[model samples]
Target: IQALPVSKTLQLDLLLGTTQRFVRTEPVRPLFKQLLEQVGAGLGEGQGLDAMAARLAAVEREQFQPFEDRHPFVWKNLLLNEFAYAMFPKGGAADIERELMGIVVKFALIKLYACGLMAHRGADFSLDDVVRVTYVLSRAITHNRRFLPNLLQTLQDHDALRLDVMTQFVL
Candidate 1:
């Protein structure tokens, strides 16, 4: 995947709030860097989606636990913002958002799978599973907007009580 060339202004805007009140970007920068390092550690050149998924699934929760525990608010906010940006269009940044959404979805899926909530056939997890997990996670991440509600309902309609249970279980 090509790295999104984030402008300094946009980077600052993301780390610091757009509002009048001053927000610190210094602390957030290292966190972002650590996130990038964690995500990129296992990726290799010319790898397919299956390879990517396998690597991600193999990632231990401990790798992310410290970050999540230390900065829960910032972590959640970053994820929520990523989802919002990915779902909605930002002017002149459609490409960036698309790339970002892909990463966020993958990361979210990995986290879910690591928690043993998702089933897989080795490196190959089903697209249906992806949709189901993403839907559940997005809902948990933000109640303000529903992402792929129709698809989630369709999945639940077919899958019986599993998805409903997942919704209850995932935090």
Candidate 2:
């Protein structure tokens, strides 16, 4: 977040991704430390920007988990919720969990891009193919642009969100 010349915009964008779409997972201790470092470096001279970029990039890095890909209703709930809030994929929403939802949506996008499970496209899922739920399919179909970027940006601006999630992951 500190990487941008506009520290405030970076912070706001980070907030939007977190409060609205981010999922409540993982401890924020390490994430917060990273954010602090980036912001701190940003406070300095030229080195600050580079440090901030690295820090922001670090904040935005993707954390991989083997998505079992169940929870169709949760996925559907996400779609229904996202659309209700006008964040139809790329439409955008301003709800808590938006960040997390975006993450889930991206996972589905990667799956689709790789031509993984095609059931959403009339193919069947393997018993252990990390099945994406119907809701995810809906988001994938309805909000491709927004959903995908939200996912990528989470990795891209992870430090910002990490700053928030840190409170939840109290030591």
How does each model score on lDDT? 0.36, 0.36
Q: Which stretches of candidate 2 lie over 4 Å from their true place?
A: 1-105, 108-138, 159-171
When summed lDDT is taken over every stretch of 10 residues in candidate 1, the lowest stretch is 14-23
**Estimated TM-score for each candidate:** 0.27, 0.20
lDDT of 1 by residue, 1-171 (tens): 124331222211221112111112222233333333333343321354445444433433333354346546644554576667566454456555444434343343335333232222323433444344445444433442233232233334545223233322222
lDDT of 2 at 51: 48
lDDT of 2 by residue, 1-171 (tens): 333243422432343234224323322334333332333333332444344334333332321111224433433554455555544445345544555544444433323221312212223333333333333344443444453455456645665444343322211
User: Candidate 2 at 122: error in angstroms?
Assistant: 26
Task: Output the TM-score of candidate 1.
Answer: 0.27
In candidate 1, clashing pairs total 0
